[model samples]
Target: MSPSAIPPDDILLQVTPALPLPEVWDAIVRPEQLTRWLAPRVRLELREGGPFELFWDPEDPSQNSTQGCTLLRFRDQDEIAFTWKGPPAFDALMNRGTRLTEVQIRVAPCPEGIDVTLEH
Candidate 1:
């Protein structure tokens, strides 16, 4: 389905990090950096429309990780938008079908450091 077709009940998360924009960008895009905090394992291609997968519990045989996610858009250190499909329970809660939800991360320079906004 087209990205615009995603439902309206999206989850949003934001934070301000005491770091520069470039650093914040790396923490979001780089697989090595992302696994440190985001997920247990992240496989991503840093390009528009690239495929990505994040495994939160790789060792758990019964858990369904965030599979078939895709990178919808990427703009240097400014913004990154992707698709996210959580486990079955999440799908039930969100009343989602086969279509995946959208997650967007925006980075901007601030007086103190950098402001990061995550919309899912």
Candidate 2:
């Protein structure tokens, strides 16, 4: 299904972080911040069409990672879009790179602080 066709509540995550928009963007793009919240090993190129790989297993990258996937969109302090696949446990479906899903993250200013919306 297309992105627009997906329902707002389906696999959608929203959070109002205390940090500013820039800091929230850092949590989405920075290596150190990524490791703290996301996978242990991450390789993000920070540009459209660049790599946005995340390795859940520290020793073996191929075992569970978004290997060979690329960023669909990248905007500083605004948004990021990247292709993603499941972990090793779902090898049958996840290994099919062409059938992978897209993960999008949008960071915007809000009344309290920064509002981050993630859709997958």
Candidate 3:
């Protein structure tokens, strides 16, 4: 099945990280590998509807973590999308609010290495 459609947003970033497409894909899918670069604490289940939690604070789980979000789309080696919650500082405004944002990461092989497009 095709990956879920990510609604258009003004926030967009495109980068060509110096890593092979497969490696880049692994970096996003493998929590163990992602912890080395992405976030200090990573808990991600790489399947459609799987849970994903990324903690930035090593000292506190409730401080800066995406605690109860789940994957909306999971296309192996191609793309992924998950619900997103803001940090604790925005707890009252964003986290406690009715709607939650979504983050999508798309990857492809490129001359430089892996071409990445992240939409939030």
Give the candidates in order of lDDT, highest first: 2, 3, 1
lDDT of 2 by residue, 14-114 (tens): 89988877778888999889999999988989888899899888798887888877899988888899988877788685557467778898888989999
lDDT of each: 0.80, 0.83, 0.81
lDDT of 1 by residue, 1-120 (tens): 234554566566668999978788999999999899888888899888787778888886136666777899998999899887767767676427767778888899988789888887
Winner on lDDT between 1 and 2 is: 2
Per-candidate total of colliding backbone pairs: 0, 0, 0
Candidate numbers sorted by TM-score from highest down: 2, 1, 3
What TM-score against the true fold does each predicted structure earn? 0.84, 0.84, 0.82
In model 2, where do residues sit more than 4 Å from their true spots? 1-5, 8-10, 91-97
Candidate 3 lDDT by residue in tens digits, 1-120: 122453343367788989877888888889998899878998888777888888888688787888888899988888899998978788775665657888888998878988888887
Superposed Cα RMSD, model 3: 4.1
In model 2, pairs of residues that clash are: none
